[model samples]
Target chain A: MPRRDPAAFAEFVAARSPALHRAAYLMVGERQLAQDLLQESLTKTYVAWPRLRDHGKAEAYTRKVITTTAITWYRRRSWNAERPTESLPDTVAGGHDDAVTQREWLWTALQELPPRQRAAIVLRFYEDLTEAQTAEAMDCAVGTVKSQVSAGLAKLRDRLGDRFGEHADDLLPPTLMVVTP
Target chain B: MTELLKDTMDQAADSLLAPDLDVQAMVREGDRRVGRRRTAVVGAGVAAAVVAAIAVPSLLPQDQQRATEPVGFAAVFEAHQPSWATGSEVHVGGRSFDAGHQVFAYVQTTEGVVFSDPSGQVWASNGTQTVGVGRTDAEHPRLEADGSRVAWTTYGDGRPTEFTVYDQATGEVDGLAAQTGDAEVLALDGTDVYARDGREIVRWSLATGTRTSLGRPTGIEIEDVKAGVIAHQLPHADDGATSPYFGRELGETLAPDFYQTLALSPDGTTALGESEADVPALADTATGAVTPITVPGYGFFVGFGWVDDDTYVGLGVNEPYQTTPLDLLECEVGGTCTVTAEAIGSAASGVVLPFGQSMDD
Candidate 1:
């Protein structure tokens, strides 16, 4: 029943687009997909705009949409054919460097994390949101966030191994600590 | 250490994201999408043709032929708990983990469930023994299986660049130049594959190695094509959420909307809903009308799909309102849903069904 006020929706898009895009990119590990995710979320938000009494709630709702939609897209896309595009990260200039390789390794490793876990990591560490906030954004119980985060970090640790180097332990939250030592 | 990881991630995001979004452009795009969604609802049938395709399979005689008591219809669903997905026992790409390492998509065939693991490797499971088919390097591996044939696309970077078909019965693999001129593949149906090449639907027959254009009905992207009956889904995902009709061919066709369940009876005369609210129903493919068939024990089953024209197959939730282990079940058209508890392991749970054909396995 809600419809977005054009002016209000535009204003929100202009103001929050960058941050939302960054969060989306972090979750999906790709720029184009992040753009799609943001666009769809904003469009959906626009549709539900009139229904929301408090405009301030839009950010939280949009964040949840991004996380949930990213997971849905990831799941739906698994069986569909990929459109050939030059979206894969271009060959890095310092391809020979170990740090660059490690960074690339970490990037690939992050991509491997299931959507919810990647979402938890991005919200908790990247966006500096708390575990509770991540849970709220993910529309899941706090315990689920904790488990997903733990699972994600464990997968990352397993895949990256020594290539991830020291400080890897810090990647996990203090509660669900997973350290090689 | 957390700060460093954050820094790297932030840097990656920064490097990838554009400096800023075009505000006016976004508003225009948003309006455009909404406008498109508003107009996307249109509704299906190629009945006489689909009889051979969807029917012949279900028409097969059952193992139980009764004299004193009537025999029932039920699909042997390979029931596994939700936790089974993250149980950390699956070996894919030579690594075993759970939760994140899980089956992303699956095709339930008579042989078993041919599924794609997180790493895009195809594996077939009949609840017990699972065998990994050829390792499909396709990243997303849009896996589609009909009978003994399974096909998926290999993606490089993120785009679907190529599609490959695997035949389980023969252990033979054939790669389709499946991507059309636009370099996009849509649907793969056995040797007769379908793909969206830009604006055109490219029908490439892998069996004959012939490629042609099917100027299909506009506004409909054919989702399922069996026995010449093509199932269409709107190109836009938003429009798909509410529309009950999958796509129209000769008449209005019914689609699965609740609990992610859909069953097209073998004869194409009956359509069943997974939700208990709408159980046994007959679909008028010509008028898009639905007539619910009441049964003696209607509310006791979770619809998996139709195993025959006269009956629908599913799991029996004997205990009301509980997460109970399901039994193989049958909801006879204009009859009751009979539960066979002896088929203990047969229940559809914990599966990512793309096209919503759960009873096939």
Candidate 2:
């Protein structure tokens, strides 16, 4: 907190910007927005440098700020229904010949999920964080995290459908329950 | 059931793990910015005292003064924090092309300078070569393809100003000319540089010690008026500071995603640019009427150029970053192309410099 020792801050930022950017990308579904979200979070972190208690918690704190900001930005009516210039083509399975193609589908599908659900799914699955950890990052109760994960998983199941069934083992969390016969 | 989903998610996660930003540069840049800011302030103060002694009553009121002067265009070039620019290296050709993320002008190239997005996407090109890479946020770099010159402004250290020129053919780099007063390059021809000083447009010839005033513009938001068309983006602070909208304010405040270059058609009757909302726009040179152009489905356009009087070629979300085919679209007057609208990369937005032909051509 005491001035963030610029040297240590630089090291921390170097190690985390990519990870933070990834999480931001998943949350906002757009590259520029993700950067903006991250920048805003980092700027805030800079302003609050003296208030953050432990240096170890800086990553967590930044992540939390990013998630909350993304969610809040999404809730704004302006962001929800605006026309998407680039709609992700249905990349779900059946036709991908390359890894890049498949990865594109996964990203597109991830983008299709709603805000809180998307964040929950990304934090839990992409960040490899436990429900408790995701909850902390999301600044929500564990129960809320559980619901978001459930809702998010359900949506991904519907969107990914048979394409996901092909690589279900790789694209989803083991904790996810498939409502099936 | 869970195992399959988990594995799939893991694969996706793995896909996202690409290296972004140059850490070594970022750290170095942070140090440079912190140091430069401290120095510029001290320098500004010393210089101000010297200027104040000889100056008579300043004719212009403070509000009319160069609001952006405090943040000189040249400073941005010098004060960059590598962390922000990430993988973008300084591209010094006949002129430096270091506009933040939006490239104003460039030539056709396979190895274009890529901005510093996590995605590692290249924004614009200059004939199979990369101009600058890994620029995330900053002013759009402007270029004159025919003459093979480019220029840009950026917030560096505390000065928030810097401009550099790269001569592609000669490989000559000029850091800054104290006489130029931190001029931001608006257009660059081989031997001539068109720079903007907030209110006035000045053309300086490197070969001749002559600086000519083309004329004064109404505001700092100058359009690339070619082909008789002058397209201008609605005014916004280059610093990302909020300001009153000069034109009809839209429901959406222009997003940083909007492309700001004003591409004038060959006849200079029509201008092309974008608003803050990231919509492609066209402006009438005669009437100042602004129209929105339809974006395609795959890539966003960052900078635009005239293939001919009636046709314009655009660059933005082209190549590796976008799957949207037809990165090049021919937008005729009153016609639109359905290219995927891309977020204009910082260095990729701006009007391409006018060629040898006049707008009447």
Candidate 3:
């Protein structure tokens, strides 16, 4: 049969799917594509359930799949759009043009980044991975990760600096803070 | 060095970070599908022993074939695609080549680098394809031809990226902890492997965790622009932006030329690229000499292989006027080559990943 007790698996899905979808959405910038990627990775993980021996490692495997999927998706020319959707929701509306538009402005700015750079930013500041972990995820070097993060952040700064409040530089710290209590 | 830029990036990342929902559904679907497939296979076995023996081969067509002969090693390109039979599994996304004693690997993602293993197990750096860390989050970990050393990255969560080196013999991880630094282990030779951190790329002696700087790279350029994935080159922008205006205007675009298919020679001197120009091109990695092989009326080269440093084999479209299957070509260093066509059957669409312990291997 399947895993005798699948509640844990079900719970795992319920808890992680939203976050996974968000990450996927950012990476590919497509709701449907993100959903598809999430489904594909999750399905693979489920098939490997019998062999995944360690429950803790499941997330790692899934994440690897997600990143790999994003890379693969990025390779497809159809996935690359000149600009992601710029229309913002009314919820976050009505502030100074620059201040309120900061997030939307930055999102558009991010679309301009290279796929890997976009992935790095999404993984680094967004996902909160360490440089080493980000490197491993991207399948490159720590230096490459650093460069990507730096290059990506620099571009964002140049593109969105005007809108961000002062102290914006503190936003993309070169080194990630350790997750401490 | 700027804080406003950093904060804006931080905020942007935070804004985009959200839990994934589709992945969860697929996981559930995959589990159910695998169980169903297992039952089908079991049932097929019983029927095979009886009346369907003669009809089996005829019923199954072989349009695509899976290569099973294990050379020194193998790597996956695009990841596994899910299907009714096996759900999602392992995928071969890009290119693999050998560098002297080890094999070098690269991919189609924005994060690109050459990973090499000298002996069947041990890995080290032998070329200039340094790892691109902090640029992407795609990880497909494996050892070189020799199994002496193990290299893999820490993917997923926003931890610093790492290409780690572990002495298979000793089990100790070399260079950079997951949280503090970027870890990249490439071109491993014995205990000495080349590692790259966010600050720079260096050769680290695993035996001591000591490092030697390769100096700042000059020709190295980091473009935060995504090249069209599978389409030919995007329209050139005379406007001077690194990526064409098309990418900036549209969120994503596919350029067929971005579908890079790389094949390396055993010694790793000559590299062959299909899916590049309309004509096949042989590039000497060491000298950076690119020579294109011309084919009349054909679009770009699709797929190819390096039989040896001097000879190559590839699959390409021969006739421009006809709707046909891709054909095979045999090529040599001097641009002499012959072509042929093969009419093959088709196969089911499914992805198969190695089971647990097998993946560890």
Q: Which candidate wins on TM-score?
A: 1
Task: Give the interface RMSD values of the models in order.
Answer: 8.5, 10.6, 12.0
Residue B49, candidate 2: alpha-carbon lDDT = 8
Best of the candidates, lDDT: 1
lDDT of 1 by residue, A42-104 (tens): 766665454344565577668877887888787888612452222335445544575465566
Q: Largest DockQ belongs to which candidate?
A: 3
- Runs of candidate 1 with Cα error greater than 4 angstroms are A1-181, B1-104, B125-130, B134-142, B157-160, B180-191, B216-223, B233-263, B266-270, B273-282, B293-302, B315-328, B341-361
- The lDDT per prediction is 0.50, 0.44, 0.42
Q: Can you tell me the CAPRI class of model 1?
A: incorrect
Q: After superposition, how far is residue A74 of candidate 1 from its true place, in Å?
A: 40
Model 1, residue A111: distance off in Å is 56
Rank the candidate models, highest TM-score first.
1, 3, 2
| Candidate 3 chain B worst ten-residue window by lDDT | B42-51
How would you encode candidate 2's per-residue C-alpha lDDT over A16-122 as one tens digit per residue?
Answer: 78878867866776656766777766655544333344555577768877898888788775565782623433434553454445455555666777888888877
Who is ahead in lDDT, 2 or 3?
2
Relative to the real complex, the DockQ score for model 3 comes to 0.14
Over the full model, what C-alpha lDDT does candidate 1 score relative to the true structure? 0.50
Against the native complex, each candidate's DockQ, computed on alpha carbons, is 0.11, 0.08, 0.14
Error of 3 at B94 (Å): 35
